[model samples]
Target: MRSVLVLSALILAGFALSFAVSEYTLRLLNMAVIAAVAVIGLNFAFGYAGLISLGHSAFVGLGAYGLAILTTKADWSPWLAAIPAVAGTGLAAAALGYPLLRLKGHYLALATLGLNVSFSIVASNWIELTGGTNGIAQIPGLTLAGYKLDGEQTFLWFGLAVLALLGLAALAIHASRLGRAMMAVRDDETAAAMTGIDVTGVSVTAFVLSAIYAAIAGCLFAAHVHFVSPDDFNYAHSITFLSMLIVGGEGSVAGAIVGAALLTFLPEWLRVLGEGYLAFFGLMMLAILVFLPTGIAGLLRRWRRPALPPQDTAAGLDGAVSR
Candidate 1:
């Protein structure tokens, strides 16, 4: 019952937000939506399955570049290209996860970082096909049937629709047996394996699912921006993606959306802070780390403490600082 209301509220919020925010703001919100999609995908690996994937931007770049190349060079429809591009990214992630997910913590993080670097290198050097440093230009806008979706207002509706569907789909997945397996794997990999959960299969599934979401987000980004370049999908961008997951409260779908929205609009909001705003941003991020260790979602959960009391204390644990 709570889930139904929450979902309904989200659906209503999307439409309500569209009307309330200005076009310029909606454009930024659109970016947040795309990024939220990518981060939500990241949650499956980093948040749910305890995998640290710093190479997510590479998968996102693949989806964007896939559509860009297809629509421009192959003269394919943007919509048509999205299908194979997303599937190919999922397959690539599964293949890559087999070896990478075997590592833990820093090792896994570095490996994924290396993958992201490799992707950017190829994108920059592959001039003939990828336009090299020039990047791909004149990418086609999104269209369905004969109607073109080119304006910010028009795209906002589309963005809202996509977010609503993806949110529901993600929620459904979270309630499934596979979701339970992922939780088990995250909590205790060895125990999950002992309990008949194929650890490797679960890891691969999480990675592939996350990558597919990133791919779709990438497709939408390309169609919206109508341009693609290696610089746009850098390793820094990967870190930002991870940061969004953390700041939004990893493991919480609502946090993903909230974090994306805040981070997306933050820079614009801070434009008044002169050129040193990022320094302030860094300070705030540190403050968040200190106070809201679980991120913004955690902060919100703290606010809702009465309805959903702390799990640890209810289990008869003492409430005290570790140190």
Candidate 2:
């Protein structure tokens, strides 16, 4: 199928680009993968269930801090630590998501935003627990069966593998009944409720799922940066994550990756734009919001869908690969 080929080609090019680029650029691409993972998770929250979450980075921070504390303080293996770190964050999200996700629209957004702020506060003040503002540093790299992923280039391969696996897993979720329920809920909560869908349960499920992804991303970020700090997962970073999901297209996996890659590499290209570049950055986001309301992934979907023949009766892609 054309879709499979397109995905395959993009993946091949991603790997090739990794090897072809400078260490510095590859480093940035690594960040793109990590951020993409987080934003992809966010897509489930805001993009799928119509529940806006502005505190996703808090979950990301929890994961990073969990791993950092385990590895640096307890001397746990980096790979092994990631499991508990991610699991703890997921469990926390599930517990909190029940109370938090009950809110909708701006209420949910504000509540989530407050959660992100609270996370920053704790991470900054809990010096002994989280190393305070200085943060936990010298986090170890992932070693698999005696193979160390230390070098930037070497790590790129590992990152690519994780991204690919997660992407496929997320795609599979899109084709399932849960995915359909998410779409139905997003389209109309009252209708969904009338049809026996547990609206609150569905919303919480999406939030928890998104949080798990963010936690994994946080683990990867901690490993990559070799450090974890309060500032790293601050509220600004939360907004950035949301921006990526929106700009990439709220409901598409490809959009999440594309948005991450674009945003990650944007600063490099903006070097030519001088000190005012960030000003341009804000403007660009606004432009995307104003003009391409559906985002890049949405645009691509429209383009691709139009290419399919009308009379053949091939079923349309349901809900844009949804949550």
Candidate 3:
């Protein structure tokens, strides 16, 4: 319940702020929300299940391209197209996960990284389907209650609503038995298997769930931008998604949301540095990594928690003696 309220407050705040920002800022904010969805899903894999996936953006691309093809090629409505796009992405993840999850640590990371690279190669070469580097264009926008979500502000309102619902769902998952099982696997796969937990199953489930979220974000991206190129979901974007999770604090839903928004807007805020902004961004990230290994959410938790009272050593000794 507390999690729900906090999520509601954040969504409402973002929705209210949308009306005041410039159109460009609103567009960035909407993108942040979409990224947040992907990052939250990532929490399931890397955060809870100890999976190192560098191919998250491939799933996102699959979703985006799936919807794009369905809407443009098959003449399907955006609403109906998202269904198969998201499901297909999940199925693909599951198929890949069964064989891929066998690898651990950096090996798994490298494999997933290869997966992203492979996706890029296929998306770039398959010009007939993905439009190659040119990407798909003229994709249709969504309609809500008879109104077109073509404008940034309108689209943001819709995006916020989706984020809120998904955030709640993520929080619920975090507190459930499934979530605990995933965490157990993350902490120690051997121990988890000894305790009758299905380690392989949890890992695959986490990967699939993460891919599903990425795909949903991709669908939203397609609907909002009305265009997607291979470049949009390249390996760089997957790194960005992982960075968002790390910066916001992995294993935390709130951290995911905060990280996405902060990183999305950080570039804009540093635009004053001109060409040097990238350097500054790197420095700040380094500082955060060194000082706050747990990320911003962990820092906030520390601040919110009440400090413990000092122990009375002399009184303790006296009490012990009397006892």
Best by TM-score: 3
lDDT (0-100) at residue 286 of candidate 1?
89
Question: Tell me, what's the RMSD of every candidate?
Answer: 4.3, 3.8, 4.3
Q: Can you write out model 1's per-residue Cα lDDT over 159-208, one digit (the tens) per residue?
A: 77887788778778887999889989999999999999999999899999
Off by over 4 Å in 2: 1-6, 307-323
lDDT of each: 0.87, 0.85, 0.92
Pairs clashing in candidate 3?
none
Candidate closer to the true structure by lDDT (higher is better), 1 or 3: 3
What order do you get sorting by lDDT, best first? 3, 1, 2
All candidates' TM-scores?
A: 0.92, 0.92, 0.93
lDDT for model 2: 0.85
